[model samples]
Target: MQVYLVGGAVRDTLLHHPVVERDYVVVGATVKDMLDRGFRQVGKDFPVFLHPKTGEEYALARTERKAGQGYTGFVCEAGADVTLEEDLQRRDLTINAMAQDADGTIIDPYKGQQDLEARLLRHVSDAFVEDPLRVLRVARFAARYHQYGFDIAPQTLSLMRSISESGELAALSPERVWKETSRALMEPHPQVFFTVLRRAHAMQDWFAELEALWGVPNPARWHPEIDTGVHTMMVLEQSARLNATLPVRYAALVHDLGKGLTPPQHWPSHRGHEKSGLKAIKAFSDRLKVPNECRDLALLVGEFHTHVHKALQLKPATVLKVLNRCDAWRKPQRFEELLLACTADARGRTGFEQTPYPQAAFFRRALSAAAAVDVQQIIADGHQGKAIRDKLEQARIAAIAALNDAD
Candidate 1:
């Protein structure tokens, strides 16, 4: 069997990044051969092996057929005649289709290197329109590779538009959607994500709640930005500045998505937006089968929207209690990520320049102290802990009422 380095390893080599691990496609080899050669088999949908010495994956060169809809439903054909060149053709993007043999011979059937040189992400073939998931992949690639100065091929972009309109996206399962979306949000320019998808009219299918916000007007005094879409893009840019994680970044892009779904209201009277964003985020998150951790994060960011606004108006204790209601407060680093996203949300409005929190240290101290809050020391067992928790909740409501009362 001939082993050839494929896909990202080849791309990373050209980008001058350290190719830490390599994925090999063993052409003209059977699973028996791989096992005999001390490779461990692991893939379910396809025949794949792990090298005994290096533990690196060595997947057999194979072809796949769409036996059903969704990412998990593909049927594969891996055997002796399935050449390495054929494996490269089935890849989503041309820039990711190159392969290099062990001796350094380049297999350049798709001219991926040329496309890389031209800063272009083009499809291997017209078959790209068949996998609706490729639209998200392309959208994420546009975001990640934007810094690399790569341009998506015009025809490829057009195909993405076609896929969006063909009900292909509607057939996509939630987990797949979130997988791509999560990856896109973690990338450098997720704003280009929606921007690219919008041109394809794909955003309507992927994030319809956010799409509904396309032309909604914001209060001129606070939102100098044209519409919700513009505000989202600005927030996306700032979220990247924070270099936030997939969930945090996803939350940032969609934090205000609830605004569009609510009834028309005047400037800043958002009486129930936190609750609204949570509802929307949960609905979308469930459809996407978001992990429990990210689902909690989405709920927190949605709830955090209200907390940050209240923090601007009242006692820090009130804000602390509100933040405590969120699971994200449990994360030391993500707390700062929350504030960064919140500040970006504020500044991204139509007419504002956000000031970095001067009270950042104070808030950290407050939260840290809250973390050390021991129930047994405070009183006793379940009775005291439950009582304290209830009291805290009541105190938070009173503080919020006071703010509204003052207003």
Candidate 2:
């Protein structure tokens, strides 16, 4: 049997990029042949094994045929007769279809190297349309390699648009969709992922709330980038630039969903969008089974991002009230993430990319002063049950007032 290093390992190696994992394809091998050589079978749907010593995956060279709907509805053939070229042909992108031999000789049957040099993401074959997941995969690759100036080929984008129009995207599992989305959010140019998806019309089934923002108007004086969708993408870009956590990035993404719900008559003025956006955030979170951390932070940012933006002008008591509502004392880290999301929003507007967000630092100082209030002193001064809680609130508010006065 001949083993060839395949898929991402080969592709990244050619690009002089860091390889995270190595997967091998064993051609001219049977299941028994792998087992006899002390490899452990791991893949449930196909013949994949784990090397006894290295513990890396070693999947038998296999070919697939579309048998039904969705990504999972496929019949696989991993017999000894399956050639390396046939296995490569079944892959989604040309760059991902190339393989390398044990002697480090590169194999480029589908011109993956040529496409790589062109900085283009092209499909391996027409079989690319068989799996709907490729649409998200291509978008993700676009985001990941965007820093290197790579773009999706026009023909491949046309196939993605066809897949989007076919209603096949709805058959994909929510978990899988979120997996790709969350990973894409962490990429260097996360905004490009959604842009590509929107371009391909892939947002109708899952990201309709975000898609609705494209044509929506915002107050030009405040937004500069009057299109709500443009501002949201800018926010996502700023979040990545700040190197914020995943929850913060997610919050930045959905902070303006309320703008989508604004009546056209209101035009440029979404008076209650902060609270109006909570519904969209909840629907998105529930549909995608988003983690509580991400969903909760997004909800907080959606409901109170405006309050954060206007922090410098608010009364000390109002600032304290916002903090209490956000449960800042109980979950300080989440509160910090909310501030970062808000900061991203402040910097996301057109012509404000490098603008400083003093609101975040002000909020941090206010939180620190309020949290430093002496609760034990209030309890020691003959304050009773309800009175102690009341006195603590009053003291915290006073502390915030002192901080505001100093500012």
Candidate 3:
């Protein structure tokens, strides 16, 4: 069977980008033929096989037809008869539709190379609108390659807007949406992902909490950006610059959901947004089936970010209370992530992009001081049960007090 390298490997190579994985499309291979050739069948929905020697994925050249709705509503057709051009036509983007033969000859029936050279992210065909997931995928691609000056083709963007307005986005599973969103969050310019979704009118369907923030006002004294949505995007961008983890980035993303609930009459002043954000964060986490790590960090940042910002003025007991509420001593890594999220939030406002965050250092030092309290010494002094607990708290409080005094 004739085999050709396909999809991401080909596309990334053309852009002089690193190829993470190599996928092959067997142009003339049947499922039975692959099975007889020692390739193990792996895909449940389609004829995908693992190469016996290389162990890389080798999917038979296939074409799909719209069968219903959402991403899964498709009938895939694959066989020895499917042509490379036909298989390429089914891809979501023109840049990803190109393939390469064994002799390294580039196949460009859809002119993917031309689009690549033009720095345009154009869809392969009218069939692009058939899958709702393509909207997120395109947005994600924009986020990933925006640094390279890539922009979506106007026609493709119009199609994305159409897909968003067609009510099909509602059929997409939460898991699928989060999958794209989480990946997008880790990109260099994650803000573009949300911006593209908003442009397509798709944010309300999946990210209503975030969409609600677009017009919401915050105090210009603190947030010159004023728009809560703009602040959120800036926080996300700062989190990326800090090389934060997924949980930290996700926390920064949802940290200001409470601002969206502020009464318009209170204009520019959201007094209790920190705690008010918990409900919205929980709803988002539950709806998306977000992992516990991500949800926990998001909740901490949502409910206590203001406390971190006001740390210098808070009493030692109050600071200790904040630490205990976040379980900082027990889960030190998560606590650090919370601090990063808070730092991102502080730096996200207008004219604050490069501002130093001394609050983060203060919190870290306070945590270290409190965490260093000698619990074993209290136990050794015959303190037990309630007495030992009381002594430990007193020692931790003393340590935090010492830290504050030193500062």
Candidate 4:
């Protein structure tokens, strides 16, 4: 049996990137052959085994035939006769289809190395369109390599657009969609993920709220970009630059959905957009079955981002209200994430990218001062039951008021 390192390990090595994991494609190997060698079988649809020593995966060289719909609708063919080239042909992208043998000799039946050098994302074969998941995968690769100036090839982009229009993306499960989207959000250039999907007209299939924002107008004074979608992209990019977490990046992406619901007459002024956005956020989050952490942050940013932007002007009571609404005392980290998301949004506008946002520090200080109120002292002073709760509120309000005065 011949074993060759394949997929991401080979591709990352060629790009001078650190390889995090290694997988192998074994040609001329049978299930019995692998089992006899003490490789533990793990794959349900096809032959895949964990190495007896290194614990890395070794999948038998195989080919697939499209048998039904979506990504999982495929019949696998693996045997001792299957060639490494045949297995490579079934992959999604040329950049990921190359392999390396045990002797470190690179195998390039599909010219994946050439495409990688050109900073291009090209499909491996016509079989690329068989799996709808490839569309998301290609978009994710675009996000991953965007800093290296990588772009999807025109022909491959055409295929992505065709796939988007074929009703196949809709067949994907919500969990699978969220898995791709959340991973994309964590990428260094998360905005590229949505940009690629938008270019292919695929956003409407899964993110209709975001898609609707593309042509929608925003106040040019506040958002120099004018387009809500452009503003959202800038926000996502800024969030990444700030090293924000997945939930923060996601909040930055969806915080402006309310602006899309503005009436035509309202034009640049979305007077009650903060409240309006809650419905859109809920619907979008529910559709994707987004985690509570992400959904809650998105909801908080949507409802109170404006309040955060006006931090310097809000009364001490108003500042306390915002803190309470964010549940800052209970989940301080989440509250910090919300502030980062808002900062990203504020700076996302053109001409505002590098501007300092003291509002973030102001609110953070407000939360700190309010949380520092001496609740134990209030209880020790004979405050009890409803009186204790009232005294706590009074003490926190006084503390926040002192903070405002000090500022």
Clashing pairs in 3: none
Q: Which stretches of candidate 1 lie over 4 Å from their true place?
A: 18-20, 264-271, 310-312, 315-317, 320-337, 347-354, 359-362, 365-407
Compared with the true structure, all predictions reach lDDT values of: 0.75, 0.94, 0.93, 0.93
- Stretches of candidate 4 off by over 4 Å are none
| Candidate 1 residue pairs in clash (backbone atoms < 3 Å) | 174-287, 174-288, 175-288, 222-351, 223-350, 223-351, 224-350, 224-351, 225-350
Better of 2 and 3 by TM-score: 2
What does the lDDT read for residue 407 in candidate 4?
A: 64
Candidate 2 lDDT = 0.94
Tens digits of per-residue lDDT, candidate 1, 283-359, equal: 77777787776676666777776566446565755765665665434576767656666766766654455545544
Tens digits of per-residue lDDT for model 3, 52-101: 99999999999999999899999999999999999999999989988899
TM-scores of all candidate predictions against the true structure: 0.83, 0.99, 0.98, 0.98
Deviating ranges (above 4 Å) for candidate 3: none
Please give the distance, in angstroms, between residue 351's alpha carbon in candidate 1 and its true position after superposition: 8.3
**Residue 153 error for model 4, in Å?**
0.8
Candidate 4 RMSD to the real structure: 1.1
